[model samples]
Each structure stands twice: as structure tokens, then as C-alpha cells.
Target: MIKPIVKDQQLLAKKAVPATKTDRPIAADLIDTLNAHQTECVGMAANMIGSNKKIIIARLGPLNVVMFNPQITAKSNPYQTEEGCLSLIGKRPTKRYQKITVKFFNQAWQPQTLFLTDFAAEIVQHELDHCNGIII
Candidate 1:
């Protein structure tokens, strides 16, 4: 289901809990919502869709990758940049990493680790911040 984009700062600020197998539907919803907003958004967190679960979807090239309980284990090459959110009014200045190593579960519930850089890394970092209750 394509869920509504949640704009309530209070709700988006709440830290998301770890996602489990039962939350599979939420991941599906995230994918659907991300696709729906593709023209203006590159990524989305579960909180943005009113689900406080550690789930996020990122548009990587032609594919949309969903990460469950995504954790940035390592990051480097920090830089400052402005970003816009589907749930926020305007772009905000924030720190981001050019490179990041993440650990998470895939849609199949299998553990996976990925090394990302450049825009991909930034998008994941932003969504991870949402998972950690960071508004920016």
C-alpha cells in the first residue's frame, strides 16, 4: 500500500524500533510510497510513513532497496550539504558522509552488509538519521 507522507515533526522525531519479519508489510508500504514520490524524493524512512520501525527505502539507480534495521557501522569523508525531505518544509544544512558501511537485513530477512559512497551513501545516512530520530 502507498501510505500518506507523515509530516508531523513529533511523529517523525521519534526513534524507530528494530523491524522484524512481521513488519514485512511495512517495508512493502515504504517501497510503494517511495515509488509514488520518486519525482521529488530519493529515499524515505518508515517514520515518514507513520510506522516507527527501522525500515527505509532508497532509490539506487533503477532499483529501490529496502533496508531493515540499517546501521551505519562506519563512515568517512564528511562534508556539509543541504537536503530536502518529503516530510519537511524545506532543505536543511546537515553533515553527511561520502562513504559509509552499513549492516542490515534485506527483504528476505537475511543479514547483509554494503559499502556505499557518494549520493547513495548520503541518502542512506539521511534515512538512518530518521531512524535515529534526527530531524535533519
Candidate 2:
């Protein structure tokens, strides 16, 4: 299990990397870290897990999806709402979209496409931002 560094712990910022033959040990560590993370119906990002790569793991309902270098391939425009993060000391309000689509890789390193809606879509976008040195 990986212990998450609080928002205050974020010191150096990094950019996203193209997912390539990532070493087994590193991937294992990431997975272990993810498995231990706790969120109350929220998503996570690669930077939050130890890498600044554009990747994320979203948890909503019974879904646990992994996104690699996930970019909003498509969006339905921004909508207003509240947003929060584990790194944040508390929950707050923010604006997000109603629908979104992204592209990424799966556990087997295979390409995949994802379509999201409502809060789930917002969660995905939030986590993806962390992968980009964003903290909003």
C-alpha cells in the first residue's frame, strides 16, 4: 500500500511522459500504491501516485478504471459545480462538465476509449489535471 503525500508535500512539479515499456517494478509499485489509496467516491491521478505522467484511476460506484496519458479526446463543454481532492484539506466548489471522453491504455497496456457523464466525468477531469501539475 502506498501512502499519499498531502497537498503540502507536493514540492517539485513534473510533466507527463509517454507510456512506454514501463519497468515491472515501477508498475508494481504504482499498483500497490493505488490499491492502498482511499477515496470517498473520487478519482486519482498518476502524479498523486508518484509520477507526473498523464494517467489516472477513477472510482465511481463499482467501476475502477485506469487511464494512461488520458486526454479529453472529446468534451461537451464546461458546466459549473463543486470539486475537491484528497490532497486538498477539505472539499470545495468548482466547475466541471456534464460529459466527456478520453483515450488511454488498459492494464495490459492496450489502447482504450472511455465515455463518462455527470459526476464521473467531472472526477476523471479533476484527476487528469493533477497529472498535469494542476491543483484545482
Candidate 3:
């Protein structure tokens, strides 16, 4: 199910809750939605599709990785940059780390830790912000 992109600021501003096993279906929907917007978007949060769950999907090179309840355990080399969202108009300036270590659960409900740098890290950070209700 390719869900519509949520543009309501109020709706996007609400913090997403932790995703349980039952929320598994939402990940598939999010992947469909992300694929639908691939031209202009590289990642998406569950909230972007109107479901306030702490889930995110990011395109890492040729692969699309889904993360459930992702948390940044470590980050380094802070840098300032501007970013645009599929759920918002125009781009906004924000801060991001050049490298980040995130802990999350995969689609199979197994724990996973990923080390990301540069654009991959940036993409994950942006989606994480959405889960936290921070629009940037």
C-alpha cells in the first residue's frame, strides 16, 4: 500500500510511538511510499505516511534499509547543511553529523547496529528527527 505523503505540519510534528511487531505492515507501506517518491526523496518516516510509528526507511546506495525504533548511539564531526523533505515545502538549514552509529530492529525483529557516514548518516538523521517530531 503506497500511502500518501503527510503534509500537515501538526500531524508531522507529533512524536511517533515505538513500533511493535504488529506495526510490521507499516514498513511495507512505507517502502512503497518511498519508492513512489524516489525521484525527490531518499528516505521516509512512518509519520510521513500518517502513521506515528518510530519506523524509517532509507535508500542506501542500491538498497533500501528499514529501521524500527532507530536511535543514534554515537555521532561525530558535526556539520551544517540544508535539507528538503517530501512532507514539507522548500529546504531548511540544520545540523548533521558526518558519522553516526544507530541501533535499530530490522524487519525480522532482530536487533541491528549500523555505522553510517556522510549521506547515509544524514538521511538516517533526518528520518530520526521526524520520529522525534523535530521538523527541519
Candidate 4:
């Protein structure tokens, strides 16, 4: 289902909880929402859909990733870029790492680690910020 995006700052500001096995449905919903608005968005977070679970769906080039409890294990080379969010108004300058190593669980609940760089890295960082209740 394509859930309504939580645009309220008060709601979006709340930190998300770690996703558990039961939160798999929420991850699926995030993927559906992202696909529904793929032309306008490259990623989405669980909180964006009013769910306080640590889940995100990101389209990095040819890959579509659904992640839960995503954490940046390593990062380097900070860079500034303009970013916009489904839960916020207008684009803003945001600092993101050029390269990052992330650890998370896939949709199947299996642990996975990925090293990302360039645009893909940026997308992951953006979604992770939402998981942390950061709009930027």
C-alpha cells in the first residue's frame, strides 16, 4: 500500500525504532511507496510513511535496495549537495560522505553489508537521516 507521507515536522522529528521481524510489512510498504513515486523520489524511509521503524527503500542505479536498521559503519570525504525530502519543503544544502560502508538487514531479515560511493552513497545517507529523525 502507498501510505500517506508524514509531513508534520513534529512527527518526522521523532526517532525511528529498530525494525524487527514483524516490521517486514513496513519495509514492503516503503518499497511500494517508492515505486509509486519513483519518478519523483529515489528513496523513502519508514518514518516518511508514518511508521517509526528503521526501514528504507532506495534505487541506486540498476539496484533497488530495501534495508532495515541501516547504519553507516564507515564514512569519509565529506561533500555538500542540495537535497529535498518528501517530508520537507524546498531543497537545502546538506553535507554527505562521498563514500560509506553500511550494515543492515535485507527484506528477508538476513544481515548484509554494502560499500557505497557517489550518488548511491548519497541516497543511502539521505534515507538514513530520516531513520535518525533528521530532515536534512
Please write out the lDDT profile of model 1 over residues 37-59, one tens digit for every residue. Answer: 88999999999999999999998
Q: In order, what lDDT does every prediction score?
A: 0.93, 0.68, 0.96, 0.90
Sort all candidates by lDDT, best to worst: 3, 1, 4, 2
Candidate 2: segments with Cα more than 4 A from true spot = 9-13, 23-35, 39-41
Clashes of each: 0, 2, 0, 0
lDDT of 4 by residue, 1-136 (tens): 9898889988888889988998888876887888888888999898899898889988988777999899999999998899998788899999999999999999899999999999999999999999898988
Q: Write down the RMSD of candidate 1 (Cα, Å).
A: 0.6
Candidate 2 residue-wise lDDT, 7-52, digit = tens: 5545314556656547223445455565666444356766665665
Location of the lowest summed lDDT over 10 successive residues in candidate 2: 23-32
Between prediction 2 and prediction 4, the one with superior lDDT is 4
- Best-to-worst TM-score order: 3, 1, 4, 2
Clashing residue pairs, candidate 4?
Answer: none
- What TM-score does structure 1 among the candidates reach? 0.98
Report the lDDT of model 3 for residue 62. Answer: 95
